[model samples]
Target: REMLVAEIEKRLPAWEKKTHLKCNGWQTKIMQNKWGSCNPAGKLWFNLHLAHTPIRCLDYVILHELLHLKVRHHNKDYIALLDKYMPFWQEVRKELNDFVLMPMK
Candidate 1:
């Protein structure tokens, strides 16, 4: 939990500075369905499980959410934006997606 918060604090601003996109706010919560989510309004919610993933995955999520501030959905424009920024986003996304956020019983 603390690690996740620290990573977000460290990464968010750096990415925001690079992308020139600011989010309204953000928080981490226990979520099973998604790694991260964002609204067109610029609020972001990240899954706490991210702490267990690789640091690069966390960076990917941060940039992914920030991009939402520009493009609302995962459409062509959004893909173009992500591709422009993180050329290896797809690999990181796949890694994060393959991670089990929770152990099923």
Candidate 2:
């Protein structure tokens, strides 16, 4: 849990610096389906299972949710943001999708 939080914290500054978007706050929890989610208030939530995945997966999910603060939907603007920030996001997303979410201890 702490590892996931630390990972988010570590990547946030650079993302904020590049995009000028601030993440109000975030929480890690045992989500059954989604890897991450962003609220309208700019707060983010990451699936606790992410910590067991690759760092790239966590990074991808972080950027995915962060971009939601700007685009709100998986529209052109959101796709553009993902392309702009992480050019290889689709590949990383594919990798993430391959992992079956296991119940965390």
The model with the greatest lDDT is 1
Instruction: Report the lDDT tens digits of candidate 1 across residue range 18-100.
Output: 99999999999888788899976779999998888999999999999999898888999999989999999999999989998
Deviating ranges (above 4 Å) for candidate 2: none
Q: Which clashing pairs does model 1 show?
A: none
Give residue 99's error in model 1 in angstroms: 0.2
Minimal lDDT window, size 10, model 1: 96-105
The local distance difference test score of each candidate is 0.91, 0.89
Rate residue 47 of model 1 by lDDT.
Answer: 91
Q: Per-residue CA lDDT of candidate 2, range 1-105, in tens?
A: 787788888887777888888899988899999999999998999999998889999888888888888899899988998999899999999999999997776
Please count the clashing residue pairs in each candidate, in the order shown.
Answer: 0, 0
